[model samples]
Target: MPIPRIHEIMEADQRILNAFSPEKLHRLGQAIGLNDSTTVLDLACGKAEMLATWARDYGISGLGVDFSEVFVADARDRVRELGVADRITIEYGDARNFSPRQRFDVACCIGATWIGNGVEGTIELLRQSVTTQGLMLIGEPFWRKAPTAEESVEMGFSADEFSSSLHELVARFTACDLDVVEMFISSEDDWDRYVAPKWLTMRRWLEDNPHDPMFDEVRAELTNSQLSYTRYQRDMLGWGIFGLLER
Candidate 1:
C-alpha cells in the first residue's frame, strides 16, 4: 500500500507541520542554546522550519532532508525568504537513505521516526550524523493516558502503538543508549495551531477544486482527520521533542 503524505494535505504554506507553537518552537531552539558555531542535521524535516528559524535567529548552518519534493522546495524558499540561503541546504530524498554528509552539532529525527521504522532505529540514524558532544532531538508522541480496548482500534491506531506513559517513552530512549537531557512538550494550544490551519487549507482546496478528481479523496481525508483528531488525538496524545545524548 502507498503511504499517505499527510503534509501534502496539511498545506505547503505551513512552515511548521508539527504541533509546535511559535513560542514552543523557539523554546525548543532555546533548549539547544543555539549559537553561531552550531550546525544541525534535520532528517524528515518538513519545510525545515526549525533549521531556517535557527539560521535566522542564531546564524547556525544545517542541512534538511525530506522525501517530499513540494516540502523540500518550500524549505528552500523559506531559507531564501529569510536571507539564510547560504547557511541552509534543503535536500529532496528519501530520509531512510539519507546518510550524514557531515557531522553536526545537533542531529534531529523529529516527528518522522517512521522513516527509520521507529524511535530506536531513528535514534541510531541520527547518532551516525552527530558529533561526539552533539545533541539528538527526537519528536515523538506518548499517550496521555492508555486508551481503552475500544478506543484503541479507532483511526487505525491501537493502544499498543503508543508508549503507555511518558515514563515508558523516556525508558525507550535509555534503551537506545541515549541520555534524556531536556525536552519541549507540546501543549494543546500548540496542537490546535498545527491542526486548525490544515482544516482551513483543506476546506479552501476543496472549495477551489470541487470538480477535480481528488475531490472525494481529499474530502474523506479531511473528514477522517478532523474526526480522529478531535475524538482521540487531542485528549489522548501528548507530544514532545526530546534532546538526547549518546550514553
Candidate 2:
C-alpha cells in the first residue's frame, strides 16, 4: 500500500489549509490581475482552496487537479458548498502530466513543484497550460540566507539540493524566461499554521491505532521533524507565492 499522506490523518480539520488568509489570496489575485473571466489551472491543488477563493472572490473559472482522490472529492464538495460548481472543476490526476482540452489564462503550482521535479522544470510544465500572455504563479521555498550543509540536511534537503539564497531562486525563473511580476512571502506564522496541527492529528491517530506498527515510524518521523523545525527552520528559511509572466 502507498504511504498515508499527512492530510489523511487530519482530514477533519480543513481549516488548517486556511493558513493563507482570504485577504492574502485576494492580494495574490490582484497581483496577477485576475478577472471575472480568467481561466486558471491549479496544479497539485489540495482541497481546491485557491480555486474556490478565486471563483468566489474574483469570479474566475478554473479547474483544480490533484493526485489525491480524497482531496479531489473534498474540493468538489467545497465547490458545491460554495455554489460555484459551475466555476470550478476538480479532477484527480497527476499534475506532472495533466493536459486539459482548453488552455488557461493563469496557471498555478503552489508549494508542490515536485510535480515538475524542480523549480525550472515546474515553470516549463506550467507554461504548457498557459495561453498567450498568460500568468504563471509558482509558490516555492527559498532560503532567507545561505544554509549550512547540516541545516539543509536537517530540513530534509540533500546537501547539494537546497537553494543557497533568494537570488538563486529568482535566477531560475529568469533563466526560464519568466518575469517576476509580484510575490507574497510566507511568515513564520504561516509555517506554524501549516505544520503545528500535524502533531495533534498524529497523536490522535496513534491513540486510535495503538497496535498499528506504522504508527511507530510515523511518530518518530513527526517527532524528529518537530524538533528539527523548531531548532533550525523556524527562522532560517522562507516561502513565497510568486507571480510570473512570460518575457
Candidate 3:
C-alpha cells in the first residue's frame, strides 16, 4: 500500500489537511503579504487549498507538489473549482526531489516536515527554493507540556518527535539562522476541527468497506486515535505555523 493511503483515508473529506481553519488560513495569507506578484512553492501541499484560495483571494500564483495521487487530483479540481486554474500548478511527485526552475517568493511545507526529516532539515530544504528576501513557512507540532515517555508512546509518537515547547520550536528556527517573523498557534478548537472529523469519516468507511483488506487496520487506527487524542494529545501537544525570514 502507498504510504499516504492511510492518511488519505483519515482525511478523506478534508480540504485543508492540518490544524487550521479557513479563516485562520486566510488570515495567515494576509499576514504573509501575498500579492499578485508573489510566487509560492508548497511542498507536500495537500489538496492545494492554500494555493487555490490565495490565488482567488490574493491574486498570487504558485506551484504545489505532493506525494499523493489522490491529493494531486483533488488539488487540480480545487483550482478549477476556485477559478484559479491559471494561477496554480499541482504536481504529483516526491516534494523532496522538486527542484524548481526559479526560486519562489514563499516556500512552505505546512504540517509535513517529515518530507525533509524534521524542522532543521525542512528549513534547509525550503531555503533552496526561496529567494533570499523571501519567506519560508513551516507548520509543526510542539509539546504543550512535557510528555512522559509513556504518554508520548500513547500519543502515537516517539518521546522526542516534537519540540519540548513552542519556545524550543522557535529556537530551532533561530539555530538554522532564520528568524520567526510571524506565527499562528493552533487553538484547542483548531485541534478539535482537525482531528474529530476523522472519526466520522473512518466510521463511515468501516460501514462501507467491511471486507476490504485494510478494514481491520482502519478500525484499529480509529480506536487508537480517539484514545490518544482524548488522553494525551489534546492537553500535551500543540501545533503552529511559523513564518521565517532569513537573518
- Find the candidate with the highest TM-score and give its number: 3
lDDT of candidates 1 onward, in order: 0.86, 0.80, 0.92
Q: What are the C-alpha RMSDs, in order, of all predicted structures?
A: 1.6, 2.2, 1.0
Off by over 4 Å in 2: 1-4, 10-12, 15-19
**Residue by residue across 1-247, what tens digits does model 3's lDDT show?**
2344778999989999999999999999999899999999999999999999999999999999998899999999999999999999998889877787899999999999998889998998998999989999999999989878788777778768889999999999999988899999999999999999999999999999999988989999999999999998889889999999999
Query: lDDT, candidate 2, residue 74?
Result: 82
How well is each residue in 1-247 modelled by candidate 1, as lDDT tens digits? 2235555865755878888876777777877798888999999898999999999988899999888888887899899999999999998888888877789999998888898788888887887899999999999989998888777766667887768889999999998888899988899998888887888888888899899877888898789889888998899899899999887
Q: What is the TM-score of each candidate against the true structure?
A: 0.95, 0.91, 0.98
Q: Judged by lDDT relative to the true structure, which candidate is superior, 2 or 3?
A: 3
**Which candidate wins on lDDT?**
3
Against the true structure, candidate 2 reaches a TM-score of 0.91
Candidate 2: lDDT over CA atoms? 0.80
Per-residue lDDT of 1-247 in model 2, one digit per residue for the tens?
A: 2215655665445632534555787788877778898999999888898889779888999998888877787899888988899989998888888876888999999888888889988888888889988889988887766667787777786544546667888888898887898879887787887777777777788788888866777788679779877987777777888889988
- Candidate 3 at residue 56, lDDT? 96
